[model samples]
Target chain A: MSTFMQFITTGLRLGSVYALIALGYTMVYGIIKLINFAHGDFIMVGGYTLFFTIPAFMKLGLPGWAAVFIAIIVCAVVGMLVELLAYRPVRKRGNNLTSLITAIAMSFILENLAQAIPAIGPDPRVPYMLFNNDIKIGSFSISVATLITIVVSAIIMIGLYQFTQKTKIGRAMRCVSEDKQAAVLMGINVNKVIIITFAIGAGLAAVAALMYIAQYPKVTTTMGATLGIYAFVSAVLGGIGSLPGAMLGGIIIGIVQSGTSTYISSSMADTFVYLILIVVLMVKPAGILGKNIGEKV
Target chain B: MLNIKDLCVSYGAISALKGISLTVNDGELVTLIGANGAGKTTTLHTISGLLKASSGTIMLDDIDLQKTPAHKIIEYGMAQVPEGRHVFAQMTVLENLYMGAYSISDKKKIEDNIEWVFHHFPRLKERSKQLAGTLSGGEQQMLATGRAIMTNPKIVLMDEPSMGLSPLLVSEIFSIIKELQKSGITILLVEQNAKMALSIADRAYVLENGKISMSGNASELLNDERVKKAYLGA
Candidate 1:
């Protein structure tokens, strides 16, 4: 029973991080219909920002966690720049194939750029531990990092929901997603909304980076690749354009991965995770929560 | 108070609008009637700044519309009810109205405008919380009109407000357009249904193959032999 509880806690923690990252994926996809392959690299950017800023802040007598704000800002700026310089031009002239190729090219650029930077070479570095304490329960203990990750992610998700449902810009974002020309008729600056979307998506990836390091504590140029693939799978599983779907998909995937690792061979965990994706695709191509909206004539 | 002269638009190599000129006086409803692919939608799209004009001027009052971006055109007291009633399908009717007032920042004013829209569109009021996609076709048209009105613009460009609707619903939507015009808003209406458009419009222009083929008083055009044969089905 305790063993089961331990796996559950671990799963929840991992799921929270995946959910945060998956949100960035889903939101960008929702607004632009582009997969934003570079979204995962935003997480890597956040990790490196923290790696550089945490020690600098600690040296200046500031708490290491203060670097999180810096990481978020840096990632958001990077994300916006990527959108403007790399994606925007291609978006105007190209079809889905062109934009998709641009996104993939962006991902490669970010990964190789990080590797080429002398200060952030391909070597893996240990991240500063933000929360190390654990809470003891009957026969099982949960780390402070795990509790904080789950709680913070939940709060952010709720905040995001309210922003989308209740705010003006939020409504505009929804409008743009539904129909770009209609949104323009409503006086929405489609480009500005897209830039904001990239900013928010990248900002969330930064928070995911924080949660990720709390558990894995490793920073590398290619760290975002695996994490990005997992989170992308989570987003697809949830229904790519649906917010609640992404959250639900991430949790299910985390639990499945944890359960498989604990009971089955650990080496077979990724295999099972991928198998679930294939099964879901075959059964429900639009995903668990996605509605197959037909095109109107 | 909207004017367009010699407006030409091209989609890559193919021209959609060739030197089309028209005007809508303040508080008057002007209808542009044409068959499909006759540049009616192209005219509205150019006026709304959605498409670039190859040559000519679009003057909304004193503002040079050609210089304005698509999103900024609404701020100059002009809005469009795009063809197909493109309501935000995933949003609620009320939320759709809120999006219409995207240019206005005042909270109380937005609230007032929403109330005005609700007063005009009572059906929309009843389904304010319902997702727009779930609404019937006629209701979506009403919501689209209400959303454009939420901007409180001096002029509106409506594209095929009667498309794909039943005869009963068509009359209902025309009545709503009549009500909107009676409220002193300048309107430029585009429609394939010439009889319905002519019945309500003060003046009319007939477009064919990207040019203004004919222009006259709406009722006179309704009686004209050529218009009757080609459009009125008389």
Candidate 2:
């Protein structure tokens, strides 16, 4: 039972991180129908930013929380730049194959650029520990860092839900997502909404990165590649464009991964994750939360 | 006031609008009557900034609408009820109406506009909380018109408001449109139901194969022998 509790806590911690990153993927895909392959790179950028800046902020007598805020802002700007520079030019043509290729290229550029830059190099660096304390309850015990991650993830998710429902820009996002041409007729600046969607997704990804680095304590230029793909799988598992689905899929993937690593074999964890994806797809092609929307003739 | 001159549009070698010229005076409800593929929809699309004119000038008051983007065109006080009542299907009727007032930021004004829309289409008010996709055909058309009017546009470009509706619903929608015009909203209506459109419009233009084949007062065109043979089937 104690071992089970340990795995559950670990799963929840990992799930929150995956859910955050998955949101970035789901949102960008939801709005523009672009998979945004480079979205995962935002995680690496955030991890590196956190690794370098948190210590510097500590030296300057600033709190660790300030570093998280700074990383989120920087990563958001980077995401917007990716959209403006890479995606915006080809957007007018509305060609899927070109956009898909652009996304893949963006992924490689960020990975290679990070590796080439001496300051950020390919070497892995351990992040400064944010919470060394642990919370205990009878037989179950968990790290304060993990608790913070779960709570922060929940808060961010709830805030996002409210923002989508209440704000004017949020309504515009929904309108654009539903019908781009109709939205245009309604006076919505579709490009602006797309940019903002990328910004918000990347911002959330930064928060996920901070949580992930804090738990794993390692940052590398290539980290985003695998982690990003896994989070994307989680997004698909839950329902690519559905917010609640992303969260649910991330948790399910996290639990499954932890279960495989703990009971089965750590080496075969990814294989099993992909297996789950295949099974889910075979049963319900639209993911768990997504409804089938047939195109009107 | 709207003035379109020598407008030409093409879809990669297929000319959709070929040098069509027309004027919609302020407060006038002008209908563009034509069959399918007659450039009626294209003309409205060009005026609403959906399609860029290959060579033409669309002047709305002092601003050149031809140069504007589709989104910013509404800022110049033009709104379009696109064909098929393209309401945001996944959204609730209330949310759909809020989208109509997308450019307006003042909270009070948006609420007021929504209230005003509900007053015009009280059925929409009852279904305000319901998803727009579930509404019947006639209700969807009403919601579409209500949404367009929610913007308080200077000129509402309506594309086939009576499309895919029963005869009863057709007359119902046209009457509501007439009432909207009576309330001082300028209208540029496009319709394949030429008989109903011509009967209500102050002036009308006949489009055939991407060009304006005829233009005159609505009643005169309604009585013309050529219009009777071709459109009215008299």
Highest-TM-score candidate: 1
Off by over 4 Å in 1: A295-297
Candidate 1 docks with a DockQ of 0.79
In candidate 2, which residue pairs get closer than 3 Å at backbone N, Cα or C atoms, i.e. clash? none
Write candidate 1's Cα lDDT for A1-297 as tens digits: 888997898888888888999999999999999999899999999999998899899999998878989999999999999999988999888999999999999999999999998899788889888888999987788999999999999999989978988887887888888899999998899999999999999999999999999888899999888989989999999999888888988888888889888888779989999999999989999889988875443
Model 2's lDDT to the true fold?
0.90
By DockQ, who's the top model here? 1
The deviation in Å at residue B227 for candidate 1 is 0.2
Q: Candidate 2 DockQ category?
A: medium
TM-score of 1: 0.98
